[model samples]
Target chain A: MNTLLDFLRKYNYFFVFILLEAVSFVLLFRFNNYQGSIYLTGANAISAKIGGLYNEGVAFVGLRNRNKELTERNIILEHQNNTLRETLARLGHVETTTEHNVREVLRDFNLIPATVVSNSAERINNYLVIDKGENQGVRPEMGVIGGGGVVGIVYLTGKNHSLVIPVTNRKSSISCRIRGGNYFGSLQWDGKSFLRAYLDDIPRYADVKPGATIETSGYSAVFPPGIFVGRVLSVGNSKDGQSYRLEVQLGTNFSSLRDVEVISTPYKVDIDALLDSAKVKDEADQLNGLGL
Target chain B: MFQTILSRIFWILLLTFLQVVIFNHVHILGYATPLPYIYALLILPSNTPRWLYILIGFCLGLCIDTFTNTPGIAAAATTASGLVVPWFLVAFGPKDLGDDDTLRPNHHTMKWGPFLRYAFCAVTLQCTLFFTIEAFSFFAPLDLLFNILGSIVLTMIFIVILELIRNER
Candidate 1:
């Protein structure tokens, strides 16, 4: 017993080291997984508070630039509002099939404003913390947009804060297509720069000129189609030569992102149901084909 | 003992403040982010128990991780740094490693010769671990190497400058 006590006492610190490391590893793997990616795990309140305070100080330096961006956005929104008002006036009171009748124009995509607390673009898998979460109706997988354009999707949400996986993350990919072109592909960050990503799987037959506009395809059910993504900087054959990949300049300047909005779509539940049924039907057909 | 504890707490707070407020915003060469806050664990009393090192490291890492939304990557790196810190003290530490509670890893305590080596090894290893964990599961060897090298060089430069200032003071 004496020798055992001595041994334990001598090596207690080493055991503590091992134990701490174990806890850290568990946290690392747990939080990085898809299920653990969203929740009250990493973006705790204390850190969010600190980041919020510091960000408030730094945001002052970019007041002019942010103001300019806001003005430009307001002008564009005013133009859109004018066109929408014209369309509404032309309708001239249609039938009152309101509640159950789903109109093609009523997308139900609402934007909830949020302030970015902490943002980083230098890392391989970058994340941002915003000042809205479950309490504010921000949920996992909801799309986010900043002053420039498409920002990212919510990964985790706390009571008063949420973590965002921006377009710069390695695990992020958005459905995008060239403006006025039928060819669409996945836009993914190469982790080389904050403002650059690549549009992949574009077939060789597609005409992709440098400086062509790329916008979200809206097929993912997350982002509304036709939202601006970026402009094509260059196009070239990928290493395998099977398809063409175009380098795109991202619309959002991630390094300076501050104010953003989370988009919530009410029809998400129906869209999910439709996708599930289609998946089941496809599996059933596959099984029947195998049996025959 | 009370003064020692207070001074130690002050150092920790100051270093964390500098890291969070100033250095966190400074990214160099488009790839390197020097986390001088690792100095939080580096400047402990030489005789401090290895367990305390790990605990302080964990707290410091988690604090920074929360602010950055990085989860446990920083905790893992700093915890590893804490584990190796005592070993470095035993191997290349100053002659007064544990002789006095006030002993620190500065040029005045360990003199210029052993102090630089200690700071260099500790900072380089910490930065390497941090970058590696940050880039975990990604096998892009060239990019990973560039990040590790760039971070280490930048962090070392900062550590040297900090040490010089401390000595002059």
Candidate 2:
């Protein structure tokens, strides 16, 4: 017993070092189950509160740019509204009731405006904090879009704030398709430039060209179809030479991202349920066929 | 002794706040971020207990992790660096120093070359461990190397500047 005490006394530093490191590793690996631990998430109340205060001062410095972007967005929205009205008039399906017009406009999705409180583009997996959260109808898996285009998707939400996994993150993958082409590919970041991402899995035979507009495919319930993603800057072949990889310039300038709109799709829950039931039914049929 | 401990606590908190509020957002060329918070570890007195040194490093890293949302990467890196600091001090620290000596490392104490070397190695170890764990993969070796090298140079610059400011006072 005396010898054991002596050994421990002599090497207590080493033992403590291991103990502390083990604790750190525990926190590290456990963090992989993202959003399960509120204390570790970026949108935790303390961080969000501090970030909110800091961004308020920084946001003031970018007021002019924000104003200009908002003005341009307003003009674009007005043009789109006018075109829709003209098409409706031509079709002789004019709706006089305001409720009908509202329903028609918001038939598929609703946009929840949120301001970015904290954003980082330096890390391999970048995340953002927004002012709106569960109290404001923000939920995980909902798509977020900014003035330029898709910002990211909500990953976690707190009471009054939320964390977003932006497109620049390596884990973020959005299904995108060329404007005129029916072929779709997965858009992913390469952990290099904030403005650039790669769209993979385009077939070799698909006609892809530089400067082509890329937009969402609407195959996922998170985002509706036809939202702009980026423009293709160049095309290259995958490492295996089996498919085409298109270099894309992401539309959203993440460094200056201030305002974003979370796409709240009420029908997503229903669509998810339907898909789950279909999957279960298919599994049961396969089991019955196998006599299991 | 008590007063010194209180002052060290004050500095740690101040450095952490600066790091979280300003330096965390300052990404030069979107690659290099000056992590001066590790400066708090570098400035510890040479006679600081090994166990306390490691504990301080862990707590400091945990504080930053909570704010930055990077839970364990920083803590692990900082703890590892803290564990090795004594060896580094023995190697690059001033010669003829006794075990009981309480000397805060700086350019004046260890001279420019040794202090720079010591700071560079310590900061590099911390940053390398940090970026590697955070990335958790070597898929983009070039980008990872770029990030590590950029952060080392940027952090070294900040550490040297802080040392210089301390000299003035």
Candidate 3:
């Protein structure tokens, strides 16, 4: 008893360190997915205020760039409006109502505007912080897009903030297909450059051309079909001789991302629940088939 | 002693705030996150109790983890750093130093060569441990190596800059 007491007294500090670290590790590994998400809301709110101040100081420097971008956007909108007017005139003979038009517009695409609060480009698994959150209808697995093209998928959501796993992160993989080809593969970041990613699982037999645009296939509930991902920069045969790896230049300049839109799909929950139940039934059927 | 404790606490808080508020947001190169503020925790007085040092280190890292949404990453790294600091101090203890000594490594106190060596080892170990745990089980070996080296270089530069600023002040 005396020997044990002496040993404990001598190494109490080490024991405490081990105890605290073990507790922290358990907390981290167990509740990491959800509790860590809540921290972002408070952090975002505080950082957003600080970012606001920082933006004010640098507003003058960015004015010219912002003006140019707005002007270009105005031109595009004007052109789009003209085309729509022409189409409306052509469809004038058909019975048209305000409700039909509103539905038509809403059916094409829904955009939820969000501001970038924090962004990282220098990590293998980079995440972007956006101001919109669950309250704003931004949920995990929602698609995010910026001015350039497909930005990323929402991974974590807070009360009034969310974190996006951008295409630049190795952890993010988007199901993509070539614009006119039957071949599909996963678009994954190689943690090398912001402008580039790798397309894996593409069969060597498929005719892949450089500059072929890749877009979301709408297979996932997160994004609608035909959302631009990037263009193939280069392609090479893999070591296995069964697959080809294509280097793609991402459409969005993740480094300069400021404003983004979270895509909210109304049918997500219903579809997800149906699919999950189907999976469970399939597993049960498989088990029954294996019974003696 | 009270002033010393108060000042150290103030500096720790200030550095932690700056890390999460300003430096954490700065992503300079596409895989190298600079964490200059960690130096504040690294340079705590050598006489601080081992258990207290480890606890403070854990808290420091936990605070960062909470802010960054990276669970266990900073905590693991900071704990490792705290464990190693005592060894480092004893190994590099100043010759003929008095028991009442409270001297810290700075431009005025320690010679430039020994100070640089000490700072390099401490900062390098911190950065290496941090990157190792953060990239654990998720990244390629080459990627992990690059991240550690890149972060250390950037962090070293930032530390030197801070030292210069402190010297001027």
What's the CA RMSD for each of the models?
39.0, 38.9, 39.6
DockQ, cand. 2: 0.24
Q: Write the per-residue lDDT of candidate 1 for residues A1-292, one digit (tens) a residue.
A: 9999999998887788788888877787777663244334445766898899899988998899999999999999999999998668546534322211212222467878888899987899999999999999998888887656789989999999999999999999999999898899998998999989999999999988999988778888787777777899999888899999999998888998877878886767689999999999889988889535
Candidate 3, position B54, lDDT? 80
Q: Which candidate leads in DockQ?
A: 1
Clash totals for all candidate models? 1, 0, 2
Candidate 1, position A74, lDDT: 100
Stretches off by above 4 angstroms in model 3 are: A33-292
Report the Cα lDDT for residue A39, model 2: 35
The 0-to-1 C-alpha lDDT of every candidate, in the order given, reads: 0.80, 0.86, 0.78
* Candidate 2: tens digits of C-alpha lDDT, residues A151-233: 88999999999999999999999998998889899999999999999999999999888999888888887777778788999
lDDT of 1 at B21: 80
TM-score per model for chain B alone?
A: 0.88, 0.95, 0.89
The reply for model 2, stretches above 4 Å from the true place, is: A33-292
Q: State the local distance difference test value for candidate 1.
A: 0.80
